[model samples]
Target: MRNVSSPYLLEQLMSRLVAPDAPRLYTNGQPWRDARGRGAPRHAVETEFKAEHAVVDLSTQPPKPLVVKCLVRELRIRFYAVSTIKNYRSAWVCFLRWYRGPLDQIDQEDIREYLELLVAGGASASEVSVTLSALRTGLDKFCLLRCTVGLVSPRKSKQLPVVMSKKEVQRMMEAARTLRDKLLLTVLYATGLRVAEVARLQWSDFDFDRQQIRVQLGKGKKDRYVMLADDLLPLMRQLWRHTKGVGYLFPSEGRRVDRHLSPRTIQRAVKQARILSGIGKAVTPHSFRHSFATHLIESGTDIRFIQKLLGHTNLETTSLYTKVARMKATAVASPLDRLRDEPGSSSESSGRQPKPRPSVGRMRLEVDPNPDSNGAYAVTLGVWKDGQLLPLPGMRATMPRQDWVSLQIPLQDIWEPTLRCLPTAQRERLESPEFFSQLQREVAKRILRIRDAEPFQALKT
Candidate 1:
């Protein structure tokens, strides 16, 4: 007997240990040694690779250990993720060590006990769930029958993602120690990109003329476009000039200059900024993405549009942010507060308040629905002259122009916009005579009164 000095030889030996109906007698760890204690005993346990028919299920029906070759073959055929394959392989290897008996004799009750052992050994619920999933994938989906069927693992606690306030996000950027780190944080929040998606961003993905960033090959192997904030365009142009506009958006630190920045690096940058900005929450890089979605939800952005920007496959995934949205535009006042002599302000308790909607007379204007940019929309106000609503001379250009300007946002049903909501979508719609007529009626609703109007101002004009 000689000590197996070669790892290749050991791998070959390990692979052959699981043969059909063979007693797994070698405890490779118990130190099988000769009289000289120089090496393993001469007793040769069969070390050979044998092929078996790929069976669908071995649950409560197999007499031997898991067919390693069959499992590996099945894994490759299905093209599972590399990490998933590694986890599945490790799980069964450990399971085989724990249960020396034939795998067919094992039942659901035994699997449950093993999971309990894992829990007792200080594994988190998530870890146990992952292990259980691996078992189901290897034992049932790939290798044989579902050895893990009907066995329930503990549910992981649902925790909402931490979101930084818009101001906090700004502070984080300002707090960034380096220009590259600052830009990375900006792109992350602006696009609602996953850390990995942002890491893989290349120079060509940015389309300045169209004002959109192409997120390439995101989760689930999908791609989507996100808006580039006009305010941040100048910063990006500077970056383009610095890099001569070629290669990955996030450059790698290693000698291989062509490689994109790693996700871990982006995360490290976020952490550094988060600490410098003094935010107390668990502000990982993903938090910025959560903040991005939550902020969009708070703004009047439509959920469906948000779903597209976030590259979410389902509307439900996009809707999760609605739960965390402050809904500042439509924060409802509690009925109890209305009964009080002075209503309690939500801002006073929370250090913030919902923005007041612009209003005119009694008419509540809708916020501009057009989302081409996050720019301010100049408002047009029709002057009431001689009982006729008329545009004043140079008024559209100068007077009252700034007075009615409002940012477009959606309000909850409880709170409606009070200002003659001028939409910036089309300038012609504002000038049309019909526009004034509808506005007049909307204002009349707020006042709960109606008045007849004559054409005195039309004659003057």
Candidate 2:
């Protein structure tokens, strides 16, 4: 292979991926190449650019790049991230299973049919997009084929991110069992680092003097600095002293001290925190990143600044926070508010009181078949009526438990959940009030939802 001029910043690709899994967690399961190491960095490892099909060696046994081994070699030659290579390999395997045609010979229609097959098999838009992106990139870079050029991906429905309120964040932190867990949750929301980034964080990355954390080689393999929370610095230091972690900030659990914590572990911790905090917002690790950006926007930070802090190459990506953010748009005064009094404010209309919950010996939850803006199904369990369960069609039971109850809540605050809702909603901190009252109501609804799920419907029997 000859030294070639490529469009990519080849130098930036150095200091990473030369050694195999040296710092697995930090470098997406690959090690950074030490410049001080004896060998030359693997940058200029590709064949010379071809003119009139002269670059690629068509004379080989497998005719080069057509074989999986050759394709993987090409990926390493270009210094692609380990995660990228793994994902691309999976996508390639899937594509090969679907279509047996030659890689360089597949036409636009073949690509379209494969995409349709993926859609028909119930692959989500994001999943389909990843597969298509992998094919486009792998084929173009390795085989120099561009079969998916005119292919249009399935349009995705953009759901607003689940953003936890500041109070909810406080409660989440309070819910963490150990100091390390608390620090993990705090760093996530404070710095807006991805869960993976937090998992792979090193002590050297923190610059207490500058109050910034250098996020080296993040999502797009781009390094950028993010603000280190002043309030969190004390707790961070305390945990640092407690754990004595050096290479990776949050080391793995159960005696694998050499490796950093897995992203799944952090996710589980965040989920546990959400449960303890009594929040039922399907909170994931990414929720903290979304909340960080949204809260910053709500606090009136410039969009461009948020973009740089997030290490987003595109401003439009950072601008996504604006949709979920409650800022000037939410503060816009409604013209109806100008009239303090209604056109005809009378005692009959103005002083109408809400009907109180019906007094009953035993009130139970019933699933409502209605769909609303909040979610697909709702449990109508607001207030009872006339010795029977009254369905509040318009109301949804979404407000998380506001008070701190006993650590052992059963028989006092919340009811023991049934087996049906155990798998999915076990994390759900069911509401409080009475014996088998609000808490049972939420559990019953989750049970119904679990039964409604296609995969779990068999369990309904």
Candidate 3:
């Protein structure tokens, strides 16, 4: 080495000696001499001239380490919310590891790549959406600019709601093992209140004297009055006695002492009751709402009235139950049956005598598992035959109406479910003139449909 007085060249050489494995940079091949005329060693010259450099070691103090705590504290002092602070700190920490450099060196591209990796790793739509929101919020607050965040739109799938008949609903309520569970399902059906609304109900919502239930802020932030069924009044009185002290109408364990049971807890109870009832339908807390709508439609209540009671914003939403409630056309006595039975009618006059009277087929009036105080009665009109009573393949029978003509059957062999066991008045009204006329009209309609279908199905050659 040539002895020179260049202190800068001597400093560069000394700096290289600190990390012998580090590649050389700016090797101006000349040695510099010290003030005393003796060449200073590389290590001694570097130590004397170069600024302090801290070496990083887990066991020892770091040399010139970036203070992450200082950066985070400064961010917090800037009035960042707790959640924002957490999100920003997390993103920053990730950035440090990703680039392995000081915070100042990380760029927008680094953030983009990290997010892309997150998506590539198969994140769910909701999860990815949340993470994107967090990252965007963090960048805007701390980085002072909106970064390139991916667009993730949430999509909703269409699903038809579940409904239950009034009969099926009764079965489910009866299956309920506890008083609390029974009333829970009853309120759900009666008021058409959502599980959440029912859970949040207060004892004051029920006005016993007026026989009305006040549903406060029901679905869609609407309030409505639901009539209390007369049959349920006794049950309600008993329930009130036991639940008098509780702040919530349906209080349960783990809920706040002042608050009611959770919507999910009520839903679970309904699910269990449905399973035990052995009625094969997906009966949920909302099933009561469906049954309420269906039963109201079946009872000849106006759809508009039902819509208001249900708190439905649109009438169309309430109209779906109309299709589910079987509308019975006027019953018709089959001309064939009437003809064969009439003593001098042509059916008997033709070739052979009338065949042996076959067994009367099953009755159609379905029993309501949970009937109201009023007797359960809903009329149905379907085809009937005389020779051997052949039942409708797909349909079940509706309640026998006052207009239906009942031939007096000998009490020896058969017991009719439709006919109330009554003496003079009840027996006389079973087959009225109005009932026979209604039957004739319905039979004419069926005959017209049969005629129209025959022509339509016939192929034109």
Top candidate, metric TM-score:
2
Model 3 gets an lDDT of: 0.59
Show where candidate 3 strays beyond 4 Å. 1-157, 254-256, 329-461
Top lDDT: which candidate number?
2
Output the TM-score of candidate 2: 0.62
- Specify the poorest-scoring 10-residue window by lDDT in model 2: 401-410
Off by over 4 Å in 1: 1-77, 334-461
Best-first order by TM-score: 2, 1, 3
What is candidate 1's lDDT per residue for 11-37, written digit by digit as tens?
A: 768758768565544356353343556
Clashes of 1: 9
lDDT order of candidates, best first? Answer: 2, 1, 3
TM-score of 1: 0.57
Tens digit of lDDT per residue, candidate 3, span 357-404? 333223342222332354332223322334332222221212233212
Error of 2 at 271 (Å): 1.2
lDDT winner, 2 or 3: 2
Q: How well is each residue in 1-461 modelled by candidate 2, as lDDT tens digits?
A: 64636534354355354586545333354544545666755567766645244223323434333565556667778888988789878887778777765544767788788888988999999889888887777665545555777766668998888998999989788776556777898999998999888998998899989999999889878899999889887887766664674778888776887799999988888887777567889999999999999999998889899999888899988888999887565569676665546566464467767766433333455554454575434544333334544332323333232211121122321323232223333223223234234343344335434433634446576
